[model samples]
Target: MAGRGLHHVTLISSDAERSCRFYACFLGMRLVKRTVSHEDPGTFHLCFGDEAGRPGTLFTLFPWQRVPRGRRGACEAWQTSFRIPSGSLDWWSRRLSEADVPHRLDQTAFGENCLTFEDPDGAMLALVEANPFTQPAVWNSSEVPAAHALQGLHDLVLKVREADPLSELFREVLGFTEIGRNGKLVRLATHDGAGGTITLDETGRLARGQLGAGSIHHVAIRARDAADQDALVQALHDRYGIVTTEPKDRIYYRSVNFRSTCGLLLEIATDGPGVDVDESFEALGMGLKLPSSLEERRGELELLLPSLPIPTCNRHVFEEIT
Candidate 1:
């Protein structure tokens, strides 16, 4: 029942257009899928990732135009971090400045350099120079250069009232090993590196988090296949008395979700029949895609969902960098 790594982190956004600008244009992630939320057909579900929308690289969003801003506190996935090349922080700083995206250079307690920033909806994000550099999948089309493009998800930070119980579950059921600790921060990692790291920050005094725009919906861990996913679900039930829902088909992947001891939502997601299942590589994210159930009402749903703007590189900034 060893987990692969992270499948994706889902977040709520107030506006789809603003999210696209921040994530796609400025951050340089490609919008690999554009679809409607299965739960709420009126809302847009936008998925951003590497060129292929790989499991560890995905950041999916549900945009609710009128949702209120959320408050960040305990029992929340506080920040999402992406992996960047070791020497690319300076280039990223300059690019962030040029794009008017406010960010600051900071270091973790473990001394890894990171650039922290926020999206239009105020979702916290960071780029860390942790993992070894790898060529970006969207190199040719991204606003960022190949050398500096974001590689994939680095890790996630979870702010919890207590870390011990959750940490134990991760070790016993999720196959994570405690790698390091620094005061309130306890770091854990799976065998895989891409989106395998997690830092639990114990903040017992913080208030409970509220769900709304700008808050993380859930963090999904990778399940290699149906059998792997079933094994995990069984282990959780047998060990911790945790009950998970039956696997729900998400078009690209299947998922089973449950709440952690700290009240943070977590999901186990299978990795097959990926984003390329329905669209060709070249035409990914170019059109609105609907499931078979919704195909008949595509016109009505399209009218309900707001039109999204296509993301493109700013020629002025691109020229300056070139």
Candidate 2:
């Protein structure tokens, strides 16, 4: 069976508020959920995405204040990219400049215009004008206008020591089609458009990556339902002798995680019981949310975790544009 598409990308952040300002205020994404990490209760887990916090649009972050900076090398996701409307690069370029975010414009081998930049914590990011202009979900409170708002994740760039094994796994197991290659970069994507693309770079000589702040933890692929996820888990074990962890309840979605042959962590997530399950659509991200398991400890946990400031967009900055 073919994969649905990407679900979300999770990253580690050094400061919660700084990351929020960059993603919510500068990039025009909405902070859809505020909660604590299930694995580490002390760290904050912030979920950002389109207005509804859809699976393909989700970008989740775990803020660990004291973590060291991460170095990008082999066996790591090097860059995370978002989809932008065609012909909006110039507007984005000026906006990034006004926000004091350093960025450079470049084109991929496939001829898509890209604006590459780094987050405050040094995580590599990009905006690619891949698809035609389509109106994305508009957050009424966003500093950016609806016409130029970000669509969703465009693609991810992974650097690894060996590409052939992972490449085979993506095609044979994940149902990705090899679309194109430019030298060492090989592009693959599912037939589904949103968050479906991936670029693999074979860099055998680079050192293994160190996980810390400003590093991507894992990228999740979408499973249409529970049965779809089971098939993917079974295929991994039966065909390649790869073992995956049993599905873990993530509150929003159930996930099964495994390491690819190239040592990159990947997850298959069921696309139900979404972010709005715990909170109403209109009140999302306004209050701290805890899973049932943590509900009893909510009072204590809130006092232990550092409070994050609510992000507000600078209206004057956006008003200056156009």
Candidate 3:
């Protein structure tokens, strides 16, 4: 079935608090959740996004204290794109410059102009004009100075050794059609355009990507609910022999993940039990809104976590708490 759009994109991090500070201050996102990793404790999982903490806007961090740094040449994620106002390219450039942020300026085959940069932890990311090709975003009630904040994740590029199996899944299974194909890259996309496009690349049998500050954990696609997710999971198994787990509640939403043949990771997530379900959108990240069990440990958690609000340039000093 033609389904819901892009959900959140998850990634791994070496330092959760430090990464959180970078994203929150620099990107103007709200810290929606901070908890121990479901798979491992001592390790932490954090999420950042607009006040509402909607799907497309959600970005998660998995702080694996032992992961090593990775190189950027190939075999890893190419870049993550963000949406900005139509004429905000100049403003963004100035903001990045003022922040002393290191980035690159170039034009994509789609003809959109872009500026790439690395986060404090070396995660590759970029800012692109949400111009003549994109629609205006609905601002979040809890997002500060809302209008200028990012609408959501624009798109992401995955540089794999091969694109055949992965590209086939995007179209034949997920319903994303190949909208643009060019040298080394094939782009599959959804309508919202916020989760913009998924670009699959054939950059040779590149080295396997390392999970560090800048590496993606998995890209999550939106699934309606338990019933819907079950059906979709079955579809993947039936059609492609790709198996997925039963939906597991992630506190905020339910999800299941599977690795693609090309080595990319993908997850299907439900939209409900939204950010507001746990905390009001307008009041998110304002306090240490922790689970009752974690409440008693807040003092220790806070102390263990690094300081929030890392430095950044003019526009917004986005910070992230990994």
Candidate 4:
């Protein structure tokens, strides 16, 4: 089955408040939802994205408060990239400087210009020039103007020791076509620049990365519906001998996760019942939201979890990026 595009990317953070400031205040993503993780309800699961929290726009995090810092190396998603409008790099550079967030501007071997920076917890991220075919929804409440705001994710970068076996999975199982390659970086595109693209970087000498604070949790691929997700899951098991989790309801969407040959976690997620499924668009990310199962203990959870500043109308709390 052919995959649609990227659904979302989930990463680990040590400080939810700091992360929220970096993303919502500096980077200008909407704090779409705030809820507890299904697996570990004690910790928070925060969602950030474009205006409406579209599939490819989603950048989520699990705040593992006391976890140790992770090292970046092979067998990990090293960077998550967002698409920005053409010619907006200079504006972004100035903005980053104003916020005192250091970043470097560089061009890929494939000719895409990107600005790379780290979040509060050192999760690597970038903003690349958007492909003409990919138009991400503009965030109206963004600190930056709509024209200069970050678009949806352009692609993701995975570092591994070998690319052949992973290439097979991208081509055969994930419905991504090998578009181009430059030395150690191989580009795989789902719809030829329509959105979801992955670059596999072969780094034979580096050690494998550990999962902890500031590390990526999993890279989720987009599926149109349940049938499409099921087909891909079946293909993974039958063809690659990969064992994946049965579809688990994530409230926003249903997801199934598995690890790659190199040990990078991969998830296949449906595109709907989005972040606004429970909360309305107008009141998104306003307060702590709990699923029905956790509603009974909402009072207890509220007392335990630290309160985060609301980015919508309360921008003063995050006035300084330092």
* Highest lDDT scorer: 1
> Model 1, range 1-322, lDDT digits (tens) per residue?
5768788999998877767777787788889999988879898889999889998889999988868989998999989999888899999999889777789999977789999998777889999997573444643345677688878888899999899999999999998899999999999988545688889999988998888888999999998988999999999999988999888988999989999877789999989889999999988888998989999999899888987768655433222111
lDDT of 2 at 209: 83
Off by over 4 Å in 1: 133-139, 313-322
* TM-scores, each model vs. reference: 0.94, 0.94, 0.85, 0.93
Candidate 2, residues 190-302: lDDT per residue as tens digits? 85356888899989799988888889989899998888899999999988888999889988899999998877899999898899998999999989998889899988998
Candidate 4 lDDT by residue in tens digits, 153-180: 7888889999989999989988888989
Error of 4 at 141 (Å): 2.3
- Residue 306 Cα positional deviation in candidate 2, in Å, after optimal superposition: 1.4
Q: Model 4, stretches more than 4 Å misplaced?
A: 192-195, 312-322
For 161-180, candidate 3 gives per-residue lDDT tens digits of: 78877778777767788888
Q: Residue 113 error for model 3, in Å?
A: 1.4
> Which candidate would rank higher by TM-score, 3 or 4?
4
Q: Indicate the TM-score of model 4.
A: 0.93
Candidate 3, residue 293: the lDDT equals 55
